[model samples]
Target: MAASVTRVFVSHLAGLPVFDPGGDQVGRVRDLVAMLRVGRRPPRLLGMVVEVLSRRRIFLPMTRVTGIESGQIVTTGVLNVRRFEQRPTERLVLGELLDRRVQLVDSEEGATVLDVSIRRLPARRDWEIDKVFVRRGRGGALRRKGETLTVEWSAVTGFSLEEDSQSAESLVATFERLRPVDVANALHHLSPKRRAEVAAALDDDRLADVLEELPEDDQVEILGKLKEERAADVLEAMDPDDAADLLSELPEEDKERLLALMRPDEAADVRRLLSYEERTAGGLMTTEPIVLRPDATIADALARVRQQDLSPALAAQVYVCRPPEETPTGRYLGTIHFQRLLRDPPFTLVGSMVDSDLPPLAPDTPLRAVTSYLAAYNMVAAPVVDESGSLLGAVTVDDVLDHLLPDDWRETDFEESEHG
Candidate 1:
């Protein structure tokens, strides 16, 4: 390896900023495209898929890149604005290579690939996969098991540039284990048609979760491609606030049409949120959260928190109210943090553990005020109550952040690159 050349993981290069010789940023690197060939050697790097300012993806041939380093990539100061069309020979590192299952030449058991390390070849003109990180074994094994190991690329088999039934299943199964944001990232790097196919393959809840993590444009695009009824179900599966946010971005006619397709109660909740200004608490909260009567036992509260579909932020605290449990009815009472519930005896009433000191948020409260309130109390979610002292929803920190970040924040992929 040349002293000047950096050996970096494919993950590190995925979103690095690309700049021209003049130091002007042209776009962010979305994926490294490469071609497999007939030798023991790794596939050769063909170019980069760059997502430019127009949100259109373009191909930058390897010859145009001058250098790769921490934080950014230096290019030959030239680029083509045309959308990228992958040749039959090309494959994406982040999208197609990561999370693949490959078999060892000497072993029948398959290993799940974690990541691949890539390095520039001699003359500093081309990059290729150098090493693969793989995990093997199950926890219940009596012998050596459940370990992650790194090996030369030649040690593994089953990687191919062509798409096969098994390859598609491997990809789908691997993606099933990833976080929603990770899935969204992989989806973003796929072609629009492929993205739609994958979205359709995912269950409604999983697809909804993944869609929540995608850019608004991508969210709209994938939803637009789904059947109207299916799209409505996916939206209904998403958090009310997130679904509302997505709906608010659609053209009025489209928004109303989709809303009409949704379940009446879910549509009503989204409609209520739509009435609030985009920058207010009402606009940032999910209409459904774990709400229990003040007299509910700690065991009951804990059970609510344990619901599989409750998001971490929403599960962090449970709102205490005088209730018709679905929506607070009797009156606004107080709140119970999950930590408190865990510490109290199961027989203890939530009313006894309520954090009465923390003030409830008014539905119309500005986003800025909500941010301050959460920071002041170190709360992940704050309850939103109407003037009638009925719980409206709970504004979560994640929602606040979604609004605070720049519109194109998802596209700004520069990371603190490592020197290796």
Candidate 2:
């Protein structure tokens, strides 16, 4: 948390200049990232999306931020140059949360959120949204303004409840607290028109997650409803293999059109997966598995595993490669399980601790053989390599089960059956 400012409304921080320790301007704040919890709990502030001089937006983790004054922010000069990508559990304060309708818990009076104040916890680096400034009225903040008040976040109710509504805004807010599968179940029961509306309203990453859980027909319908560019963006957010599967369901022309609209790098990964037989290891593998260089330390592996966005299976181990860390990476070396990372000292070189005892799976390995490999080794995920020994991707147990399950499995109301 920034030491100079204990509490600052997010609105005030928006577009504020961000500076490094030596008084050099680095970027301007574009938005704040917050992780939403299960219930009424205030979302923890994750970091800021800062746009640098070159017009490139990057993530500035809160841990690296040192001060937040009224005019500018000060960082420890550390920054990650990767483009900011919102995860399924994250919400952007400015883009998604502002100007939304909510109700005061005690009064039940409707209000529109105008701003939110975040505060750093005592003696801790973490911050959480604590107060909300809302305007009471029927219209947005710019029009028909009425009495405004700052209330504790707990005083608001509509942000997480599944209120009865056909409007996409309310529906999206309702789905905010739900797991992707749960949201998919709710969407499955919605009228197709309503389902498309909700899907269109959700942010790209969130929509991608929910789409992955939906039935193929529903996925196709909702995707078809979105604009071509938006559809491409959502596909880019999905796992490469899942995106390839969804693209496979489309007509050849439609698939090609969407692929053409996607970023070249992202589209390339999907194209590679599409080249393989649908029932093979290559087809089932996700291209975004954690890949590390041989020179990385156990500490580095642990840090990569701690990312909140990684699926448990993907986070279960890291693949060590020669170079070009991305999938289809340089010569495949071996894998280091999470347990191995935990056992070794932080300073230990990952290359020295590599677990190369097990033979890696070939990209064309049949689905049955892939499943057998996982079961035989009790591994949650298995690496997929090509004939030339380049690491392609990793197939996880979940994708295998998705393929193995009955076609109508997702349609079953498992929650009701278990509770009944």
Candidate 3:
């Protein structure tokens, strides 16, 4: 049976003093030994080193210990120190962490770690007190291995974070159900001014991506706190259509102020989208779609997609639209999945790969129609155009998914992060 845990103190056995209830001189506390058994449980009896008369030393089991103090471990009754003998099990202490890769638990999750925690056991007055371990990921905050909220030692009632596959499977499940809007809601809890500051710190494109995730109302609230120039910089980074929607949501004076602060080219593009009805294709499209030439090589098409730096946005499906040589604008070609690009020969001409059978939507196409077209065609993005099939822009899947996810999704993400 494991010994009861109570307050205990430790000191050098040879230097410390101990005495019996009758005031008879007793042996001093010395070294401590903990068992190192692989696969089998460690010994329940914690041992201590003792030094006595005639220059003799002995190992005493903690189970035999009766009294403890800041400086001494008084035996159940004082006796000759030689009565206890050292065991072979005491020969090896657990090695340095780097010497062996040990399996341990972390946050109730299985974590491969560099070291484990150890401290004196209050009840075990033997050599080295042994009971609870601050296991490097070995023992600490014990969440359900992968819970969104990680509670500390004080909050933990009890736990058994297994260091195995069960722990990893739980983490994977939590990740799959995680959503972006949950992230936005948690970010919303911070003051709008703080949010704007964070937005400003992000690159133009990243800021735009975050803005897209935010609700229109929240987007305006955050932008309202930023300086007009900074707000304009973020707007310029967003898709022209998205910027127009956000601009429309703002007070007219704020919109005009931000537009005035924007770069001339960016302002013009946003203005063009803003002129369209909010419900139309032109109003919901992205102006940054990959517009490739018919004569371009597969490598050139891939390079064009790379320039956008759109990670985690399903960039594999790049829109193959107009060529630069075409008069006012070339005919809008079909979109290609990134996987197809990789599978085909690098020398292949992009024109041969164009799938003209793609469904087309005009600038005035309704939102419902665009969404249906995306679903029916299984396209990552559907190019929106005019009567002449001129490329207006493309509607990507991420924008659609973001629109569908709830605002509170960000909260889940915030709660999941350990560092946060």
- The global Cα lDDT (0 to 1) of model 1 is 0.80
lDDT tens digits by residue: candidate 2, 25-69: 998786788987877898899999786765555789888888887
TM-score of each: 0.65, 0.63, 0.51
lDDT of 3: 0.55
Please report the TM-score between candidate 3 and the true structure.
0.51
Between 1 and 3, whose TM-score is larger? 1
Tens digits of per-residue lDDT, candidate 1, 49-155, equal 88775566789988787788667888898898777878878778766776666777667667767788877777667777888888774334577656898888888
RMSD of each: 9.7, 16.1, 22.0
Choose 1 or 3, whichever is better by lDDT: 1
Candidate 2, RMSD to the unseen true structure:
16.1
Model 1, TM vs. native: 0.65
- Identify the candidate with maximal lDDT: 2
Q: Candidate 1: misplaced stretches above 4 Å? A: 1-89, 93-170, 414-420
